[model samples]
Target: MRKEVFVAEQRVPEDLEYDEFDAGALHVLAVREDGVALGTGRLLYGEAAVGRTGGDPSVGSLGRLAVRKDARGLGVGVELVRGIEAAARGLGLAAVDLHAQTSASGFYERLGYAGYGDEFHEAGIAHRAMRRSL
Candidate 1:
């Protein structure tokens, strides 16, 4: 499902979409009434998020957030974000961090995330670091 959105639709390189942390990241999947996946996201905490969170154990890293075009305008993306935040809180995290595509930074800001740091590129798409304190 993530491949469908990230690799196929968004043009993110497959090699960059999947990484070493997948095995330990907490993944969340959104499905339809028929069990067809519509969106997905991942949460990385503790050691998994240390590098991304500036070595802060209390901050979880949220990444690989994707929602199928057919499901856009619906609340799947928001739900996935909320779910990731819940997972972070469950792990005793104080906040959640993410590298948001600059074009989508407003979407995350609407959900309470505040962007920081200079813009950078990941998988060929411009991005900005964003975070929200739980």
Candidate 2:
């Protein structure tokens, strides 16, 4: 389902969808009651996640968050973010950061993330930096 959203529906280049960080990151998969992957997200900690926000050692960066189109509005995204936050807290992280697509900033803001920097383009889409303390 993550591949469907991040790779196919969003047209994100395949290489960017998966990277060296996977092996080191803690991934959370949201599956259906029937046992299918409905959505996914990752919590990055330690040195590997440093570059996510220009080397902010105290922050855990949430990345590669994707919910299947069919799963939209099913509360999957909310659960995924909360799961990532739980993982971050387990790792002793003080905060969490993410490059939220501009369209989703409000969604994240309601989840407690605060926009912190100028908007920029990523994968041809507008994005803004957002953060929330764990």
Residue 73 error for model 2, in Å?
Answer: 0.4
Separate clash counts for every candidate: 0, 0
Q: What is candidate 2's lDDT per residue for 7-111, written digit by digit as tens?
A: 788888888778999998899999998998889998888798788867988899898899988889999999999999998998889999999999999989999
Tell me the spans in candidate 2 whose CA falls farther than 4 Å from its real position: none
Residue 76 lDDT (model 2): 94
lDDT of 2 at 67: 92
| Deviating ranges (above 4 Å) for candidate 1 | none
TM-score, one value per model: 0.97, 0.95
Model 1: per-residue Cα lDDT at residue 12: 85
Model 1 whole-model lDDT (C-alpha atoms): 0.94
C-alpha lDDT score of every prediction, in listed order: 0.94, 0.90
